[model samples]
Target: MASEGAEYDRTRGAGDTAEATGEGGRETAAPPDPKIAAAVAAAEAAGPQHGETVRIDSWIWSVRLVKTRSLGATACRGGHVRVNGERVKPAHSVRVGDEVRLRHEGRERVVVVKRLIRKRVGAPVAAQCYID
Candidate 1:
């Protein structure tokens, strides 16, 4: 019985360490993709320090509200997207605090722009750019 308990303790300790280091006992924070990094850098350079305005379609894509910029633009042109209760074109400017309503995939998603990001990013990063 003592041997079994010792084995259990070792297994639990190993599991904890594995989780800390990520799967396969390796750290997970790999370097950012070069393309993504470049895009983000360009976006940051073109806009103000923060709270800058961006095109509606670009904002939607950047926030991961749509899968792609073309899809976002299509929704805007199809009248499936509105800003502050008024229909807007894809080229319309979206600023911080603006309310956006997008109808897609048989559902409506309403979001408020909290921060503007012009480049596409991972889902976790994109989620930080808006308020639902």
Candidate 2:
């Protein structure tokens, strides 16, 4: 009886050996296209590591420039955000010494990146991330 059950388990898992063994590996992310997946992989491999890079949207919201991260992303999508004189997407990486410009509420804010931060911080702490 045990051998029969074992055989059944093997038969069921034979098609996907990796998942069956529960190895420390990841599966495909359901990317839309092979080319797109390759591009994303290349970007990730080429980009700076986590400690060296922060997403522009997160940095903006972190430094209290925007009320929320979503708003920061919206500003980027609307072309109200610029980095180093070029409009950038929300996912663009921001580094120290980069200049950031934000247009909001009938005003434009220009600040240079001093430090990279990810979390929303209090005003005092946020101020340390950029120089106005």
The number of the candidate with the highest TM-score is 1
Runs of candidate 2 with Cα error greater than 4 angstroms are 1-51
Clashing pairs in 1: none
Weakest 10 consecutive residues of candidate 2 by summed lDDT: 23-32
Please give, for residues 1-132, the per-residue lDDT of candidate 1 as tens digits. Answer: 999999999999999997876743322342245555455556556554654568999989988989999999999999999999999999999988899999999999999987777777776556656888
Deviation from native of the Cα of residue 41 in model 2, angstroms: 33
> What are the Cα lDDT values of the candidates?
0.82, 0.80
lDDT string for model 2 (92-119, tens) is 9999899999998899999999867666
TM-score of each: 0.64, 0.61
